[model samples]
Target: MKPVSLYNDIASTSYPGRGIVIGKSADGSKAVIAYFIMGRSENSRNRVFAETEDGIKTQAFDPSKLVDPSLIIYSPVRVLGNKTIVTNGDQTDTVYDLMNEGQTFEQSLTTREFEPDGPNYTPRISGIVECENGNMNYAMSILKSADGNPDCCERYTFTYDKPINGLGRFIHTYMSDGNPLPSFEGEPTLVEIGNDDIDTFAEKIWNSLNEDNKVSLFVRYIDIASNKAESRIINKNK
Candidate 1:
């Protein structure tokens, strides 16, 4: 395997769009997970992360200003037994349901594709971190349009068993800001996960995002041995 570039500062990039990061913390004791959303439109920006019984969901910061809830609002994270599922779209539920039926993560995502929103045709990115037998492993998937063609869908899945400490993989909806947003290309980028402090890490990520476009962020660090988790949430709207 080629040496992966370590992205330590996310703010270096103006826009990475919705992203997911999964890896092990520097301490080598916790499984780290992070998901964040950024938007250029008012509809996408008017949102906040609300904690749910199992995970987190996006809600309109001002319900009255919400124009379309179809694609902007959905549960971004959920927990099913020893597995935690996160996604950039409603596929979170699809993966959850499939897992409940005893199906694998990749199999569940095979039935879904990129977002219907055209021109951009935003890619659907999803991940799952499973903790069991005193160990943790993760998988990430991205479903995108084939060369901007709405009719063709391209799917990619990456799995990591026993991820290296202080390292994570990041996959987002877009490669960068564009007139018609371009889909994220190639494999997920490798990133460094500093210390085990959830607050500092979460704040670093939130602050790194383009201030004007950033909306909300959620970070979780799960102890592999005890199955315990600590989380931090930051919402610009709040």
Candidate 2:
């Protein structure tokens, strides 16, 4: 699909739920990965992205207000050797752990389907960036229900072996807000990555999100040649 403006795609929707973007930076020197979460409920909004030994995890911004940790509390990003894994749920660990044991990204996700959250059955959206030997490639996956039917799950995987400069793939848990939120459809949206540095990119994404619903955002850029990474995290709670 033709690349679209990242800002507009996000700004037009009040709630895209959780999103992940992966691509090659404008200058083709780094691999870019961004993940953000938005929520309408107090329990869902009470969150912050905390840095972990390898990547980042979600934590209750106000522990007392957190009603359930089952779906919200888990690492959203993890690093395993030359691959960086990002997802909207605990499946981050599933991909990391299984890949660590010699499983391919697609193979690792076979063990998982969509989230068990009823009506919506929120899709398990995920992406992985692999930088090795001065080269970078990434892939995105979505485990969702057949339309809104939970009895059948649909899984799709999209790979970008030669990502275009200044372009990224955007995938999220929901298509838009609803009583039973709609799961994202079709392939991930192709969007412009531009040439902004980590901070600028993160700032743009955070600002584009609906002010009242945005929770936390994480953006990271990895040097394709050196494997060095620079990251920025923005938490609405603070």
Q: lDDT for model 2, please.
A: 0.94
**Can you write out model 1's per-residue Cα lDDT over 147-205, one digit (the tens) per residue?**
78988999999999988878888888887788788899988888878674888788777
TM-score of model 1 relative to the true fold?
Answer: 0.96
C-alpha lDDT (0 to 100) for residue 177 of candidate 1: 85
Q: Which pairs of residues have clashing backbones in candidate 1?
A: none
Q: What are the clash counts of all predictions, listed in order?
A: 0, 0
RMSD each, Å: 1.5, 0.7
Error of model 2, residue 78, in angstroms: 0.5
**TM-scores for all predictions:** 0.96, 0.99
Give the top-scoring candidate (lDDT): 2
Clashing pairs in 2: none
Error of 1 at 77 (Å): 0.3
How does each model score on lDDT? 0.89, 0.94
